[model samples]
Structure formats: C-alpha cells, structure tokens
Target: MLKFQEESLRQSVNGALALRHQINPFLDAIFEKGITNICFLGIGGTYASAMQTVSHMKEFTSMEVFAENAAEYITTGNRRIMDGTLLIYSSVTGSTPEIVKAVEKAHAAHATILAFLDNPNPHLRELCELCISYPQNEQLKLFMAADRILFLRHEFDCYDDCYENFDCYLADALISVEQSSDSFAQEFAKKHCNDTLHYFVGAGNQWGSTYSYGMCYWEEMHWMATKTVSSGEFFHGTLEIISRDTPVTLFISEDASRPLSLRVAAFLPKICANYTIIDAADYPLIGIKPQYRGFISHLVTHAVTNRIDVHLEAINCHPMEIRRYYRCLEY
Candidate 1:
C-alpha cells in the first residue's frame, strides 16, 4: 500500500460491518411505518455511489429507486418523492450546502431521512431520522443500506447469507486491490504519466465508477481533463472523438454488461493506437464467491484505478492532495 494506511482501511471495514446492527433496526422501523419509494440524494461521488447502488438493486428487486443530484432535485422535484419516500443522503463532512438543503426539503415534505455522515453538523444530524457515522467506508455504507432495504422488502431471498459474508468479502476487496496496485495499476500509471487527457468507458454498474473516477479523481484531484461515456452511448457520438493518439481507458466488469465492454474493446484497438483496458476479471479473489463477483466488480475496478492516483502523483510531480479550487474558493 503506497499511500494507504493499513489501520485506517481495516478500521473502515470493521466500521462498515458494525453498521448492520444499526441499519437492521432502522429498516425495521421504516417498514413498520411503510415506505413507498427510495430516493438517494447527494452531490458528486455520493450521488454516483447512489446510482451504482440503484443499478445493483434493479437487477433482482422491483423497488422504485431514484438517484438524484441534490441541487437539481431541490429545484425540480420528483413527483414520487413524498411522505412515504426513504431519502438517503451521504456526506462525510455534512457541511455540503446542497445536501443540507436537500435534507431540509425532504424533512418539510415528511420524507424519512437516512443519512451516512462522518462528523456531521449538529443541525444536519438532528434532521436525519436515522444516521450512521462511518467516514472511511462511505461507499460500503451506501451499498449495504441499499441491499438491506431490498432484503427487508423481501426482494432478495439470499440476503442473510450475503449479510453474513459482508466483512469477509470487503476485506478480500481491500486486500486484492492492494495486490493489484503493486502490479498492473503501477504499470498503467507509469505508462500514462505524460498523458494530459483521457477518455473513460464502462457499462452497467461500472458506469458509475467511470463517471466517479473521471470527475472525482481525474478532474477534481489531478486537475486533468477526462471524458467518461457509457459503453452503449460511446457509439452514438463519443466514438467520433476517438483518434490514433487519443488516451483511452476502458473499465471491464464481469457483470451482465460484460458484453458491452467487450464491444468497446473490440472496436477501440482497431482504431485507437493509445488505449488501455483494466479488467476486473484479471484480479484474484480468494474469499469471494463466484456469484458475488458481479456485485463486487465495481469495488475491484475502483481499487485498481485508484492505485494509479498514487503513481501519477510521483511521476507527474503533483500531489493528489493539492486542490486549487474545490474548498479553497467559493463556487
């Protein structure tokens, strides 16, 4: 682990596992009260995680789910959002103005609020009907919350077995990702150290990872230009931008959407001279079951791609922690 703290990562996994107790009771109370729809509302990475969870849930469950941008949802409300809605808001800082406003609006509408926070503001914490504070594994918290909701509603029959294996599977993800960092990810970073722009492509649940990496990691952290497109949408207009010199990165997951990534892979090599494919299938999983691979593919790809950040920092002579305009300036 080059930039990762082992204790912090272990603590995060344990913290997320402990949330099952808290989440079970919260869902018990919500189902007793009756919830009609689930809405995951946030900005940036939080919202992207919500979208990924929504896609994951839709594979088996028939629940009404929506992932919305906090600021946009406040301005143009969804008709399905009412008193019976379960609104989930994720923010580590809890000081994000847009999320705070979304909480207030949901509260006024009598919607039930479930928030994942780190050191949340007193006002924001008070507003939530149920709050889970775990700063390290925010994505895991969201995924677990969504999965629990599905199980509670009687959508996922095997949820108990899945629940029992949460800690083990997540630990596997943390470990496998570190192993991947030392191998393919480091090589990819060193190869692309001089590249200024990148085009990212993914499909299914991985589409969220592509978007999150492009915006949160590349644009926000590295101050680089990145264009992320879904594999299905890459042909419509995005394919025209592909040239012999384009720096393209493709994310291949082992889900039902593997065919979509395969299609892109088949086409890119024929046209583009500079392109790299990072497939999650290449990673080894010691403890994870074969059936769970699709469910955990996003985490594996995220772990692999994130390793490049540390390498890019060393090669490009810019620390990933340096941000010029995120919180330092007014938006």
Candidate 2:
C-alpha cells in the first residue's frame, strides 16, 4: 500500500518541515524574556541550529551576533562573555564534550546558560539555568533547533519590513519540503569514473546548505575529499584548481540565489570533468517559490550519498569502514 515514490518524498519533506513547529515556541519564550547579544554553540548536526538562529536574528539585531565552534569560546575563558552576553547551546545528546565543557565555562563566568538538550541528561541540567529537552530522535532534534530561530526572530521584534521578509523565508522553507525518498545517489556516483574531488557552495542565509553533509559525507561515506566554499571564494580563488577532471555539484535555488547558481552553471562546462546542476526551480513546497527548488534537490543529493554509503558498506568498500556513520559517532 505504500508507494516508494510517495514514501520517499514524505520522508525528506517531513524531515525538513517538522523542525519549525517544534522549536519556535521555546525560542520565542527566550526572546520575550529579554536576552541581548546571544551566542550559540553546538557540534555536528546541532551546528545547523546555530545557523538557523543567526539567519533569523541577523534581521532583528546586528549587535555582535554570531555562532562559532564551541571550543573557540572555551579557550578565552570568561572574556567570551561581556556584560550583556547570554549563551545558549544545542547538543542533541546533551553530551558532546566540547559543548558540555563550554556550557560549564559559560555558567561559571556568570553568563546565563540555556540548553536545548535531547534528553533529561543530568550533565546538561547542572550546567545551565535553563535546560529545554525535546524529542531525542535525529530528525526531531533538528525541528526543535530550527523552530527556535523563528521564535527568536519574532522576539527580537525587527522593523515591520524586515520581520515580514524573514517570516516569508521561514514560511517557505518550512512549508515547501515534504517527506519523500527518491534516492539520487546512484545518479551522482555514476558520473564519477577516475574519481575526483567536489566542491559545494552557497551564500546568504542559505550558505550552510553547502556544508550540510557535503564535506563530511564524502570523507566519511565515499572516502572522497570534498571541499565546500562560498560562491565568491570558489570563483575568485578555488576556481583555479577546477578543471575537466574535477567534479562540481551546483545548487540553484530561487530565493535571492539565482545569479550565483547561474554563474556556476554557466561555467561548469569549461572547468570540470563532470558537472551536475540541480534545478530547484519548481519544488512543490507551499511556502516556497519555484526558485527555491534547490531544497528538495538538496535532499535528493544527501539521500543519494547515504544510499551509496550503504552499498559501499555491503561490498566492504569504505576506506574508513564507517559502518552506518551515526552508529559510529564517537560522542
């Protein structure tokens, strides 16, 4: 009774859309409580949480806001927190050593600590004044992390125009992707013959799309060295290394992202041994326009890579022998 095509689509889109509803209320609560100069820290997939926070908050306040590797803050000691700084963390498991240590340090320094943890992990509770737990599954944790951004943006109370514009972005991203599972991995791998490196690039609020599994998936699953950079950097400098033997996967979306996608698409033939351009121009998410078709395409790309990992594992081919990567995550 379950169709593979429809089933696959549902899986991907639901995975993408679920986060908004789950995370928004928690973050909106934080924003309403009046925290200024917020910094978020996390590891791995949790990193996306910080990205989502920055994307929404950037519109509301420019007050020295950014997210960085947690370790970066840990080394500086109390100096990391100014009079107004409030630190929040997202660690799905409530554990990732560096993040845990950093949260402890922030609390010791008298910085307010808020944590979005995956469970009622005792370590997380001890280190923060506020510990918020969500469903612990990989997909749902992402939902909570993402929705926090929308809530935070609303709390910051941007000017009417800025708030409206970001809301549109949040709406499109949340509504557009539906759960689906069409594996495009074989199609991606089929293009590689002698083996080659790939670079994924994106900019603006969507730039995090480049590194989402692009670099890590290649190294962990495919045993390839993939590099991800911004479109401008790839054009100005990295383009020199690109040639007929190099492979490039270009993501083109509709939202304020067309020119760069087109530029890369136009230059593909001259610079690569192989090139694939995904047209995210007409994806059927209710909140997104056709230009943002790239989201569904991005899902397909990630699915394909994981599928190929499964095949490689079946054949005993992965160099790292990364058996089901998550199961191998060292914590």
Candidate 3:
C-alpha cells in the first residue's frame, strides 16, 4: 500500500469498462465497410501490449491480425498494410514521432486508422479516423476491441457475457489481486534490489507482460539491466547462462502455452537457487469465467508486477519517474 490509490485505481478501471459502449459501436461502423486484415502498431510498452493482443486474437479467429513496432514499421513497410487494412494504435502522449509518421503512411495506403489515447491531443485526434480517450487500461481496451471484432465476425459467442462480468467484477478483482500479491512483490523487491542482472521468462499471453516489465519497467524506469525471453525459447540459448546465483523470474499464465512455463519451472529448481514464479492461476479472479481467464491473464500478471515496481522504487530510494536521458535528451 505504499503508493496505492484505491479510489483512483477503481475510477480508472471503471472508466475503461465504460468505453465498451463506444468501442463496440465504433468497431461496428468500421466493420460495415469491410476490412480484410487488422494491424496493431505502437512503440515500446505499447508494442509489447500489442504482442499480447495479437496473440490472443489469433487463438479464436482466422482473421489476418498482426502487430508491428511503429519505429520498425515506418522503416520497413509491411505489405499487409493496404487499402482494406484496419490499423489500431495506442499512446499515452499521442505525439510519438515514429507513430505519427507510421500513421501518415497507413493513411496514405487507405487503411482505416483508430487510436486509443490516454491523454488528449488534437493533432493525433485529427490524424486518426477515430480516437477514444480513456484514463488508462490500454490493454483492457485493446481486448475489448478485439473481442468486439470477434463477436461481429461470429467467432466469439460469449463476448456479451464475458464483458458483463468485466464491467461488474473486474475492478474489484484487480484490486484484490494487488492487495494479495503485494507481500510477494515486497519480498521479491527487497531480495533483488541490488542484483546486477535479472532474467525474466514468460510464455503465451503473459510473454508481453514479462517483456514490458523487464524492458519498460526495470530497464527504463528503474535503470536496471535485464533480459527478457519467452519460456518456450529459454532452453534454446538463454538457459545456458543460468546458475545458482543468477536471478530469474518466470511468469505463468492459464493459456494454452502454460505448459511451456511449466517446463521451465521444472528445470529451474535443479540448477538455479534464485528463481521466482508468478503464476496467474495462483490468484483468484472472483467473477471472471474460467474460459475467459486466458484472455485477461496478462492483466493479472501486470497487476502483480505493479506492486513489485512500487516496492523496488521504495527499497532502492530511486523514484520510478526519474530519468537520465529518456525524455530529457534528443536521441
């Protein structure tokens, strides 16, 4: 509870859920025009979140869905981005130069562009065909949009029931998860605060969360050195570097790729003494259905890790917001 603001968190979650009304209608209008493919574009953390979204969408639908790093997409154009493509984007500032340039190219290609903005910027709003401003929870909004698309395509029959649960119970469930996971996060942070390097591994839907935490949170925010890899690929080359003293954290989710993380968990104890496992199944989701848990597994992992972030900040006396060269200098 160091920096937890209960009311603010509740309001943010509720605000995201409330956008479902607008999201569905907006998606419906676009679908009526007929889209041949869907593309998600972003940078850094947003790119990581898009990875999870693309992964989740591929599971249930056969639609051509993919994600691209805006920086890379602008450099090496994707052939799939064409006249019938539906491009989705998300940003906190809505002014990232790479994203703006990429959007311009997509627009010229006649792709219908939609953006989710955490902060309002008239320039970005004018560029996007449609823009929705929300408090936070970009991941949830992405999932909602994906689910609505699936429903419209006659692929997701239970979308309404699942979203109803999300509206009624998700906020409280996430709050409970934060409260329950705080102890583990505190202990993990205290033990690893001074570690020189950290290895993060995860698979399936949680891979994006694992990557973002290691890169965006630990490296960018905390100024720590970390390497993130998928659990499925750990044994390929990353496992060779593991030793008893090496710090490693594995994230496990309830998706089909859960077995990949389980395989890593089985091998870690035999060689590495310093290993931590954060499993979504260990936490209770309250009213969320079992079948839909896989879809939101990344969100649960994020909630758990948010506690680790705060604890690490407090233990190291390093504010999470302070930066040396991130936004302060020209890159």
Candidate 4:
C-alpha cells in the first residue's frame, strides 16, 4: 500500500454516508417547491462523474437528467436549463472559471443551483442557492442525492435498503476491494510504467471512470498519452487501430452495458495479447445487495485504480501532484 492511508479513506467514505442525512432533507425541501428537470454541470473530472450519474438515471429513472460540460454549456446553452430546472455541480476548488460562469448563467435563467465543494470558495458560494462543503467522495454524495430524488418521486423503492448497507458497510467493502486488488495494481504499474500510450474502454456506469482515468489520471496527473472510448462505440473506428502490442484495458461492470465490455473483452484476446480486464464482478461486496452493485461499481473501480496510481507514482519518480502547466500559467 504505497501512499495509502486506511483511516483517511474510511473516514471519507463514512463522512459521505453521513452527509446523506443533510442532503435528503434539502432535496425534500427543493422537491416541495417543484423541479422540472435536473442538470449536472461540471468541468473535466467532475463532468465525467456527472455523466456516470446521468447514465444510471437513464437506466432506472425517467427523470429528465442532463450532464453537461460547464465550458460547453456556456457556449451553447441548453433549453432545458430554464425556470424549474435544478442545476447540480461538484468541484474540488469550487472556483473554476468555466463553472463559475455556467452557474451565473443558470442563476440568471431562474434555475436553482446546488453545489458540492471540496473547499470553501465564498465567491462560488454566493452564486449557488445551496452549497455544501465536503472534502471527499463527492461522487458518492452526488449519487446519493440522485437516488434520494428518485426515491422521493417513487421511482427507487430500494433506496432505503441500499443506503442502509452503504452507511454501515460501504467503507469496509471498498477498503476490502483495495486490499484484494493491490497485488494486481502493483503488477499493472510495473508492467505499464513506461508504455507510450494506454487505451481504456468501458461501458455503462463505469464509462465515466474509464474516461476520467485516461484523461484526468493518466494524461493530466501521470503525463501519459491515452485515449478512452465507450465499449458500445469501440468498433465504430477504434477497433481497427488496435494491434497485438497495443496496451488496452477494459473495465466491466454489472450494469446493462456489461455485454458491450464483454464483447470487447472477447475480441481483444484474439488480436491483442496486452489487454487487461478489470471486472467489478471479481470483487464481491460482502454487505451490499447484488442488485445495487452496479450503482457503486465506479467506486470499486476507483479503489482498485487508486492503488495503481500510487504504484505508478513510485515507479515513474514523478509525484502525482506535479503539473508542468495546468495551473502554472494562464492560457
């Protein structure tokens, strides 16, 4: 466990569960006033996370949910972002320029804004109608909020049963996944440490994790070149580019799109010997219901990949926190 802190991880997961108490009440209040649609607006990693939520909502709930890149939303506004829309956002700094501007636009449109911030930014706070400062597990909190909304609408009857397990056992289950996946992660780091390019593929709810891991972690943090594609779209143009030596990883989850990833998994072995498959099914959540595993597969994927990130940092001798130009100069 390089750079691992068990207590901190446990606390973060537990704290996210506790935050649900605060979140549910606020959602209840907002629903009373009426909400026509839900819009998830964010930048970079946050935007990808919003995509995961929207994907899940599409499968289980009929709610009009949209995930938009904050910068793009500012350029071409969405007609759905009007009076009764509830705009949801999550940010580490809470002051990204694009996000701030997007929030301003949503505010002017008479949409109610709710933001989850990792750090307090008064300026962003002033723009949001409801802002909660939670330093970790923002994705989990976002999913919880989404589920709570669905529960209130009578769309998710198992919400209470699912969250009861989340509150009591999710942290331990996630930690167990980290422990179980550590050896594979270590080997993965050693094997791919110097690879020039990485191609990641995933489907369903796990697609966001695949996208974020490629762009945010491998590219931004590790300074490695990478490309991500959804499993459903892989054969469109991406499949021909793969050769036997090309490094590819497929993330498989228990959602409806699992078959798409499985299709890729089956094809990769015939053409590419360097392919890796990280299946959420391999790690069983001891206390979580079988029906709810799809909802938290992204979290499980993170727990496994977090180990790989630490190992990669050690092998590459490049600290994960260092960036050459991300925030060092203005564009």
| Predicted structure 1: lDDT | 0.83
RMSD of each: 1.5, 5.7, 1.0, 0.9
lDDT string, candidate 4, 229-274, tens digits: 9999999999999999999999999988899999999999888989
Per-residue lDDT of candidate 1, residues 1-331 (tens digit): 6777767666767777788899889988898889899998889988888888787878867878989898897899777778999998789788888888888988888888998888767898888888877776667778888888888878877778875665666675666676656667778788877777899999888988889999999888878889999998999998998999999999999888899999999999888999998888887777767777787788888877767888777777898888998889998
Model 1: residues >4 Å from true position, as ranges?
none
Q: Which is the better candidate, 2 or 3, if ranked by TM-score? A: 3
lDDT tens digits, residue span 179-292, model 3: 999999999999999989999999888988889899999999999999999998999999999999999999999998899999999999999999999999998899888887
Q: How high is each candidate's TM-score?
A: 0.95, 0.69, 0.98, 0.98
> Model 2, which residues run further than 4 Å from truth?
1-29, 59-63, 77-83, 135-183, 193-196, 286-331
The candidate with the higher lDDT, 1 or 4, is: 4
The Cα local distance difference test for each model comes to 0.83, 0.55, 0.90, 0.90
User: What's the distance in Å from true for residue 217, model 2?
Assistant: 1.9
Give candidate 4's error at residue 19 in angstroms: 0.6
Candidate 2 lDDT: 0.55
Q: Count the backbone clashes (under 3 Å) in each candidate.
A: 0, 27, 0, 0
Q: Kindly give the stretch of ten consecutive residues in candidate 2 with the minimal lDDT sum.
A: 174-183
